[model samples]
Target: MKKQELIHLHGLLAQVQNHYEEETGNDVEHDEYASVSVRPTSIHMSKDDHKDAVFALAAGITSELADEATEQVPAAAD
Candidate 1:
């Protein structure tokens, strides 16, 4: 992946993480997944690993955020 694309994906992941924290009024603790932690800033990886990591992070983040958003919505009953 290109440098700019990596940067953009990193930004999106970070933004989603931050949004989740702000919405729930808590700081996200990313103590696990050391690779993920260093991802946004620097991901010491090969080209394939870099692409895989970014996609994995994006998928995970999107799923978590979607779950949170779903919980916040009100359901209607007939």
Candidate 2:
């Protein structure tokens, strides 16, 4: 992919991650009724797995971008 396209994709991925974080954030101020509660532990592969997947995907994309950038750079002669 072109540099510009890679940059745009990276930006888009960042936005998506930011939005997901916001959505999953604990907006205490927005809560009308606040109460102390303990988080439940479950054997579900939904939340953490999903975030891990996104991070893995982003890392892969970033690696690809770096590879592309290096390919575009001319190697120096010894």
Candidate 3:
């Protein structure tokens, strides 16, 4: 993906994190992403940097959500 696309994805993920936290009253521990020090608006940063940040952010968000999904929910017709 292009750098612009990656940046856009990063922004979207950030929004997702915010929404999840606000709704669940839990925080997404994105220490790795924080350590990367790259935000979606950090357009001055390199594409690789944004890529790394995106990976870290995605991993953190997914990992947290996965933990919450440990219990299987029954599949039922609505």
Candidate 4:
């Protein structure tokens, strides 16, 4: 991956992690959204789903970064 892609990926990962932390975060042992028990379940965010969400988040952030980069580029002096 290119440097821009890597930076965008990192930023997206951080944003998703932060959102998750906010959603089910507290001084508790375990939250259902973030549970890890060996048992049959049907309602849970699977690994693949989580990765997909991360990817989506990363894409959005990358677009924003690209926009900002474009705005920052100095125009040629005419």
Candidate 5:
């Protein structure tokens, strides 16, 4: 993907994180992402930096969702 496209995706993921937190009243634990200290608006940063941030952020968000999914009980079909 182009650098601009990657940055756009990064921004979208950040918005997803914010929306999830707002709805659930819980924070997305993106420790690795935080360590990178790269924001979507960090246009001065390299493409690789944004790529790393995107992966870390996506992993954190998906991990949380996966955990939540596991706690639910699916209905049995007749």
Candidate 6:
């Protein structure tokens, strides 16, 4: 995953975990089949995204930022 996407996903997952911890007072870990997870996993892009829209949205936003960054670079010629 891209840097921005990783950061975004981490933050969102953290939020989910924190909330779950507060509510259930348990580990609140997502199983292997979980859609969105705070922890890393082994899977394809579409598979993971299909499992979790929150993950997909974060990844999409980060991708948009990356694309914008590429366009923001200044040309060398005057």
Q: What is the TM-score of each candidate against the true structure?
A: 0.52, 0.36, 0.88, 0.40, 0.89, 0.34
Question: Clashing pairs in model 2?
Answer: none
Model 4 Cα lDDT, one tens digit per residue, 1-78: 543444455455655546655764622212332332211122243544444444555554455456556876666988
Residue lDDT tens for model 2, 13-76:
6565456447756221212111211111222334443344344546644554565567766679
Candidate 5, residue 6: the lDDT equals 91
Inter-residue clash pairs, candidate 3 = none
Q: lDDT tens string, model 1, 1-78?
A: 686677667667778877877888755445443454446656555445556556666666666666667885577998
Relative to the true structure, candidate 1 has a C-alpha RMSD (angstroms) of 4.3
lDDT of 5 by residue, 1-78 (tens): 989999999999999999999999878887999998999999999999999999999999999888877896879999
Which residue segments of model 2 deviate by more than 4 Å? 1-45, 73-78
Clashing pairs in 6: none
Instruction: Give the Cα error of residue 29 in candidate 2, in Å.
Output: 41
Give the top-scoring candidate (TM-score).
5
**Angstrom error at residue 63, model 3:** 0.5
Higher-lDDT candidate among 1 and 4?
A: 1
Candidate 5 has its poorest 10 consecutive residues by lDDT at: 65-74
lDDT tens digits, residues 1-78, model 3? 999999999999999999999999989997899999999999999999999999999999999999889968889998
Rank the candidate models, highest TM-score first: 5, 3, 1, 4, 2, 6
Error of 1 at 71 (Å): 2.9
lDDT of 4: 0.45
Per-residue error for 25 in candidate 6, Å, reads 1.0
